[model samples]
Target: CGIFRLVVPCGAGKTISALRYALQTAERYEKRRIFYIAPYNSILEQNADEIARYIGDDSAVLRHHSNIVFKQDDGEKETKYKLLTENWLQSPVIATSAVQFLDTLFASKTSAVRRMQALGNAIIIVDEIQALPIKVLKLFNAAMNFLSSFCNTSILLCSATQPLLDELNDYRICPPRDIIQDVDRYNEAFRRVEIVDCIRGNGFSSDEAADFIFGLAQKVKSMLAIVNTKATARRIAERILKLSCGDSEYKVFHLSTNMCPAHRSTVIREMRRYLSDEKSSKKIICVSTTLIEAGVDLSFEHVVRSLTGLDSIVQSAGRCNRNRETICGTLSLIYINDEKIGKLDHIKEAQEITREILYHIHMNADRYPGGALSKAAMDEFYSKYYRSLKREMAFPLKDDPEHTIIDLLTNSPVGSERKQTAGGILLKQAFREAGEAFEVIDNTGKHSVIVEYNDDARKHIHILLSSHFIYEQKKQLRYLQQYTVQLPTYTIEKIGAGIVQENEIGVMILSNEFYDKVYGIDDELKI
Candidate 1:
């Protein structure tokens, strides 16, 4: 394998360089298609926009993710539609999420099966490769191997803190060099950051954190605090607003996935405008989720990060002092023990390994002899991390009886005997399975009904009722109007009681007593 790594720090033009490599490879091999996979939809959209700008054609690039608005020219009018119904491989340049890409490898859906044929004889760039799901690492590695060896594809594993993918016992894919030859060069180029390791027990509390942020806003030009969860971010923002003086004129912003992409983009644009305008002294403070960890190239003078995995900590550090100016900026890593660090077992184990290494290095200064964390320290960190979790690194679902059950439900071959025999039962079983509950808001401002499922059926009913049907349905007889549902204002008061279930149609909500009390709806209603 002639695969190689391109290790560049934040704001080092890695995305553009990767795209350049892909384009060169395509021209050299005369490849027709190129696949660029990212960890998030915003990133996918961002990269697609940049690629399209460089490539000089929007038609050459295709953005396939949730929230993508596609316009179809059917001659009746330019209709805004969705890309989910479109063929994924039809475009020469495809931008998608890692989940969508990997799901295609394991499942046999129309999108999954159809994209497989286009994967061959193409150049695939896996951006932020370290963010690859731990449970799917083995499956991903196997898939990469099969694609590189059998399928005519070239992969560029791009990231700052690159994981030890080849060291795993079941590893299959291998790259030529550690893509990043000189880590110090990147450090020198981006010399804007001065990492401040805040001592534990002295760190800011919820209220203190708010005060500190407000003080910083008054002093510094711009700032950002990247926390762990949405709820924490919201709490911090609320505290800041409460403590602020009258007419203080501070522009505070809260950003998280809880808001839609359109909303998030609007916030990001406002932040950028504030940063770029020198005349406007409107102090800006943004409290965000881990979504800003990678690919988002927003530069700030100071950043406060709650203690997380080492890779995440490093990425957060990258955002601060990003410009590498003469004045080295400070980044405070506050030790947050309250955060519930679940999911991604590999990252949790990596954090422990990093802590132990840091402790040992700090205790025996003469042995390591480095005042600051060195590149060798990071290398050793990842090496130890891979060695410790190699056995459990592969897909956790493999050989699990439940996966077989899920496969039967989701990927039973079309018209197969088992699928036909158990499909309906499996579909019903899926509905019975509980899912994450959501407050399904409709347009009429009325608490009409609640359903156990939030799938296509529920969506259709919500849309229809919100549309012109509400007035017509109201005119109908009271008994016939029972089926017409609407979302109410009080429904917003309910926080966490509905269990979202999945059916063949889509995601459904399992209504509970709490929902009944919140919406004041009859429990005997069919919903």
Candidate 2:
């Protein structure tokens, strides 16, 4: 099996080139499956559709993410029912997430580990591989090493800015060829963007950001402002609406993960149509979260980005000057100080590292003007960043010691020469005790139901319901629509209780009581 690493910038045809490589691999090796793993479901959905269209074969494609599988089905619910009635691995081209693939390597259940067989003799293209959990870096690399060495599989590390996966101690798997040999050559060929570091005092405030956007909207045909969070995006969009007098003249759009995939797709399609139309002024202004950082191909003459991770900043830059048609447009990286920004664990660390790098670049711009923000600079940033976070990165899943426990449980018998047997048993017992805290819901409902609640629970329940691509919830059912609900555990102790019931429709429960009581419903009802 062959390996490669592609470090092309965004909108540089990475996806298509990777797809072509995968096809070539399949044809050359006579492989049956091609696994395309992405960081997000939105990207998986987009790529799967495009592949299906190009291949001209619906049967060859399989989309296997939690969000996309259970999304609100279009009018073709019946057709979808017939299509997804079987296991996902049977398809020739499968799209999934890195978590799903890695889960199989450390799976405790038979169902979760079943996909391991399909991974053999396949072309695995990991898009945006840097988005992988830092803690699982060791485990992820080990799995890739095993697959590439023993299972007759080829791995493609694909990203705009590839992370330092190979730098890890005892890292396994190496690319056969450098996909983008000279990044500077590719950058020069595909460079259409100009970076503008806004002077600190001149940067836009919340109110001023809106005013500046409104001014741009009046001048340009379309503009996009990529902010750091959903709250800020919505607030900025609202401010722009208030400041602009002729609200009816121009269209203002707000995009974030707060909206479901179906909703976002509708918005994206509408925007594309408006931009493509010749007569329509459109004057579109879209404020979005980091969700639009990749896989979305939208071009704008002006892009204003809130300070964030360097990779994300580059991704935002990619959205601007996309076609290289714009001679000299500006991408403003504004300095925004919000305490809430630090709440994001990963982004917080990234921001700190980026700030330090910017400090150095500010002192010596002639040597590292924009180069400080390039992929090579990011490499240095993460190297130091990981060293500082080595302990955390080494054991991210400290809560789950089952893999170690299982190895000990199977390898060493009781009353044997293995001195660690007692320690392993203790760890296993602790894990088993902690596992009881999580309740597994049975989602075998007869009529599809929607769990509605406040935004937080709603998001979780939505992910669970859509986990296996089951999207037939009733929109007219209000009671079922608003409260967060989970599948009731099938254990005998949890059956036929007030908060937990076993009906034909599946295990139904009230999430509030379940969380508050801590005990199973049967015990709570007895109390």
Candidate 3:
């Protein structure tokens, strides 16, 4: 009837359990529809597949995300799919990214607002709820309040380490009911991996870290290292490959946003094959960015995670010993001294705070009886993290330092009562300004570049270039999303027109020379 939260450990099957609850509630209350939202495209893809299998009808679930592209079909099928995607109402169950869901609730664009009515009398399930950006705390809480209070919608938020949303001073949501009576019991029961802190005075250099990770992989036979940035990930992966030059049995893989969706999926599939096959003799080592930290289904014998937020560490640890098959799996947290995080203010701040928390945990272990991954530790982490980010939680506008997105959407100084004339209220709420200012991800200077990674990608690009009609090319562009990567415009420019250039249809396409078969876009390609 209102907003309810479910707190469960990573491996407790929260996905299917949440689905069961949503279905039951929908059937009982005769809800209009059910929407399952996640924070990233990776999580959306996994959940969409699982929900399709559970419902026993793939067509009943509508996937709405950046990577989703419906195949070319007959006119009837195309029209039906297009209509469902446009308004997001006809589908019985919709699996979409949080970007889409949040925009539908907050964005002022007609295309986005058109779907807002569909959310009424619906049950919304949000997975990995803590992945929300700190800047949108107040706005997100306000949106949830509107949907639950006035729209007759039920919202279920599921997270391993939930944030304290109620602690916000303004636009707070109703106090949510906890579905799980004792979350600490489940946390203890699902405890599979232990955290090994490897952070020292100035941390280890990339070469030293790579050497240590390589040695550990040789012993463990399977390991995953998640770094903070793409440059660090590629550097560590290349160094590991150089160290294991003559080792024929070892397979090294790299994953980051620089790789297209299809390429990343292919790498993940191969990693899973080697990890799951008991008879296979291949020793697998994967170096990836934080993209693989949440809602990814890969399990490793050992994991190395770059020091960041405690919540992120918990999510990374979920990838190790996930099935509880290993007797003792370890997730070593290390700090790369040479890694440059100057532009990554959030991660840097979180790292400093996490270091402090780890120091306290080591010095006073008795206070945190449930260890680092316990509820007690998570509570302290969020409390400190939120306090540090209190100023940004209001989503202050950069260009207009005097007001915030909340103020623009609700009350603006321009639309005061004194300005009204003849009993007519002036349009004071700045919808266009707010919409232009809001960004789920900072896309200020980013541009999407379609890469010719495989035969399918090339086929799409060829069609996109050769198509005579603009409508056909639009469809081809959608199909190419599975093979596209977003890079900073400055980086693209520095890479030079020799490697990246616009096609006949004005789409940015990266040549094959700069992309690697295993490591994705070459970090050294930039001039």
Query: Using TM-score as the measure, which candidate wins?
Result: 3
Which model, 1 or 3, shows the larger lDDT?
A: 3
Worst 10 residues of 3 by lDDT: 414-423
Query: What is the full ranking by TM-score, best candidate first?
Result: 3, 2, 1
Give residue 488's error in model 2 in angstroms.
20
Most lDDT-accurate candidate: 3
| Stretches > 4 Å off in candidate 3 | 73-75, 414-424, 499-504
Q: Write the per-residue lDDT of candidate 2 for residues 333-368, one digit (tens) a residue.
A: 776554257346777787778777777677766655
Q: What's the TM for model 1?
A: 0.73
Residue ranges of candidate 1 with Cα displaced over 4 Å: 71-89, 202-204, 323-326, 342-350, 360-374, 398-527
Candidate with the larger TM-score of 1 and 3: 3
Q: Which lDDT tens digits does candidate 3 get at residues 1-527?
A: 79999899877799999999999999999998999999988889988999999999999999888886767666677677778979988999999989998888777778898999899999999999999988788889988998999999999999888887876666777999989988889887878889999887788898889998998998877899999988899888989999999589898999998888999999888888888898888888999999998889988989999889999998999889886648868999999988888777878888888898888999999887667788778888888888887768778887776788888777865444433642555577766778877877767678888889988888888888878898998888988988888878677877777444545567888888777777777655742
lDDT score of residue 327 within candidate 2: 82
**Per-residue lDDT of candidate 1, residues 213-322 (tens digit):** 77776778777888876556766776776766544567777876544344466678888788778798677777887888787867777888776666777778777756
TM-scores for every predicted model: 0.73, 0.74, 0.95
Residue 140 lDDT, candidate 2, scale 0-100: 67
